[model samples]
Target: MSDAVDPRRASAALLALGAIGLWGTLAAISTRVTAVPPFLLTGLALLMGSLVGFKAFRHKPPPAAALALGVYGLFGFHFFLFLALRLAPPVEANLVNYLWPLLIVVLAPVIVPGIAWSTRHGIAALVGFSGAALLIASSAGSLGQGAWLGYAFALASAVIWSTYSLATRRFSHFPTGYVAWFCALSGVLALACHAIFEPSYVPKAPEWPFIAALGFGPMGLAFFLWDRALKRGDPRALGNLAYLTPLLSTLLLVLFGGGALTPLSIVAMVLILGGAILGSRK
Candidate 1:
């Protein structure tokens, strides 16, 4: 067991929770700001995140770690996520993307030698996916309506996010603020992509607040908190904690005018949260 008094663990718990909290609000926020092109939105959001996290870059990381950052940064993860959004409903795309948390749990011990591992994690992981399956089934009819490509993008987003999170472990020693640098690099990359593929579009005045909030909160502070937490806290616990994000996100959506919560979604939430707690237990 981890020491409760350990400052690092406490910090990690707080940071992780903070990230999850902000992330829960994302669906509601994004839905309201559909006026902006996804790619351009990605670039602008990341640019803001970069600015918010800019001070952390002073610590600086080595070259190989920097390479990993460029790949996994906003450019890689957000790009895929937004692309997924372009193709499908937020419910489906987000659920598929939730695969990252479970992947983090599964991959933790493999990447970090001293971390604990167990078969129960596999069982819990399946349960988590099963919850996601239930969600998909309930909403399954929403699929195959010309969103197959979107579905593919959503799954890919999951894979990319999972891989990116695990890969960051390799260079965890780098300052957490260095994430700003990654955000900046990703912003640049995203900007280039936007310039090439997306026509220029400006956000209406009403859209600015939502867009700015996304840049500074979820994309910015949440990422820094996640990096710091992962570097200091137990991955296993953090992974289990991540199970809450989807449930919370969905609830936020309903409350924020996105939609009503479904009976099936409640059932799915039970399975997901239950599986996460049970399977993640030592």
Candidate 2:
């Protein structure tokens, strides 16, 4: 085979794209899934992810990792995000959640000892928050009286996810093979929440499509592809490829969710993404 058709390179490229495609479509899916309670949806999607990830399961995680996963997987970003989806419009919710990457740039040093803060991260933080301000400001006029609750959860999703990202780095000895367990455990938590809160609601066939999409794609194969890409490919190129996620995600939301792009939203996207890239520079 020609060098251009190298098996490893081809597979990596395809997997990376698949992961990106799944993530990009999630907000659009959220629009169609409003009738589902966040936790109930989480339980089903994570159960599906768990089923696909069973091959990667090993023994249960160590105690500290398990504790962390309780927060990280069950009651943290994974949970908060789906809840945010229910609380806010998909576009606004997703934009706020995008702050996690910028937060991660700022937070990594705090979680990982010996890593020093840098001017680039400071710039990224400033720029990222400026964009965030515009996003909130732009949306403020028409926000429902109690919509802050949703926005708050949206911001919480970023903080929780950033913490989880940092925690994973801190607990480097934890086995990545335990992803299946994490999903399964998170599914259990979601199931409990569903039992308590959504007993009266019954799922129809339409809702299953969104839940299943999240399970098989973003929650399942995307993670597998991310691990494979990091191990087999050029890190810098993959990192650059990762940048496409936000823009594509936003594009997908606009295209499929029937969302509009106000001038402020457009500007906010540019600033947030620009700030993140600037800050992420080593």
Candidate 3:
């Protein structure tokens, strides 16, 4: 494993930032497209993303390992994430799903040889989890039985995503464009699952653009950029940047009347961002 930063790391950071920002805004957009069922929206997004990914793939083909990684990404991460969102509120779903970084931290020592855990990292994780707890308690009133189920789904999603991230290292020799193809393939699989298990789903005319946004903006380009970044940068650094999603989403919620930005949210943001920074440090 190389510790040297790639010159392209800056560009990858920018792309990751854009992706996280778009993902943060997904809840708002999805709300507007309520007429579109979650399954249909996910399926459409995956299908559209696959089209983009396939075009990229034509430029370069990935190894069997990369494709295998993508298969896990589809069935494990995306599928569970969509299901979680369907079962819970976006905020809750995101909070649960984002726990993957912590999962990765715990698994890294076992998966990545010679990686050692430190007391500092443990403290940082504790702080981050505390912040997450505050956020959950602050918004606890919004959750219900369905949201609880979504939390379960979201936790499962975190586990799957952590696995995907860890396993992807095996495919690092493949081109980033090839990795993009695998992501697209994952999306395609997600669509197939949607079609099989979630029949009778149809999006109204007004919902088309929202579905399109999910596909092209977040699902398509975001995944591509993320994979490219991970290829050139440290996963922990990327994970640190990923913490911005919750902070950004909270801001979006305040702007859109989802909730008032309370003192607890402010405190939580500090904890999450601070922890992320500490945890990602070399």
| Candidate 2 lDDT, 24-80, residue by residue in tens | 776677678878877787778878877776765555554764556534743577667
Pairs of residues at least 3 apart in sequence or in different chains that clash in candidate 1: none
lDDT of 3: 0.70
Model 1: runs farther than 4 Å from truth? 1-7, 57-64, 85-93, 136-141, 145-152, 279-282
TM-scores of all models?
0.86, 0.73, 0.82
In candidate 3, which residue pairs clash? none
In the order shown, what is each candidate's alpha-carbon RMSD?
2.9, 5.5, 3.6
Which candidate leads in lDDT? 1
| Residue 225 error, candidate 1, Å | 0.6
Against the true structure, whose TM-score is highest? Answer: 1
Q: For candidate 2, list the clashing residue pairs, or say none.
A: none
Cα-based lDDT for every prediction: 0.74, 0.65, 0.70
lDDT leaderboard ranking: 1, 3, 2
- Candidate 1 is scored at a TM of 0.86
Candidate 1: minimum summed lDDT over ten consecutive residues — where?
137-146
lDDT of 1 at 94: 69
Candidate ordering by TM-score (highest first): 1, 3, 2
